[model samples]
Target: MILFLGTKSGKEETKLLAGISCPYCKQTNTLSAITSPTYFHLFWISLFKVSTNHFVECSHCKRAYYKNEFTPEMRQALGID
Candidate 1:
């Protein structure tokens, strides 16, 4: 996941999670923070007394984007290179 940490210079820290996109299907996939649900409860409880976290699964291609990285088209449109 992309951690947004503010810097002393008043700039945002951009942490990108790199991965390969499927050529034919053009699907962007990412790794999950946790896979199994067996330790899910314990993992969550370690931090907060009550917390809520969501793991998203793409319905179309079944890919995960924890950081929600942008696509080439999006980058070009936003004038980001």
Candidate 2:
């Protein structure tokens, strides 16, 4: 018997931030935050979530910000500790 295994990313959810400006575009209320949960799978069945990815995008500039690049202001806007 053969088995298949891999990691898959789940659906992403977006949340708009208020009273926040994109550092790249300097636009207000254009920051959309999204998070993806990566799951370990076996035979196409998700076994458990390995990690979650956090990111923010600027609508105007189309720039992507990852967790490592997240600023204090951005973290506050996303309500992330």
Question: Once superposed on the true structure, which residue ranges of model 1 sit more than 4 Å away at CA?
Answer: 1-49, 67-81
Quote each prediction's TM-score: 0.21, 0.88
Give the residue spans of candidate 2 off by over 4 A: none
For lDDT, the strongest prediction is 2
Give the clash count for each candidate.
0, 0
RMSD per prediction, one decimal?
A: 14.7, 1.3
Q: lDDT for each of the candidates? A: 0.35, 0.90
TM-score for candidate 2, please give it.
0.88
> Which 10 successive residues of model 2 have the least lDDT summed?
17-26
- lDDT string for model 2 (1-81, tens) is 988999999989898877788887789988889989999999999999999999999988999999988889889877789
Q: Cα miss at 68, model 1 (Å)?
A: 7.2
Q: State the RMSD for candidate 2.
A: 1.3
Candidate 2, residue 1: how far the Cα is off, in Å? 1.6
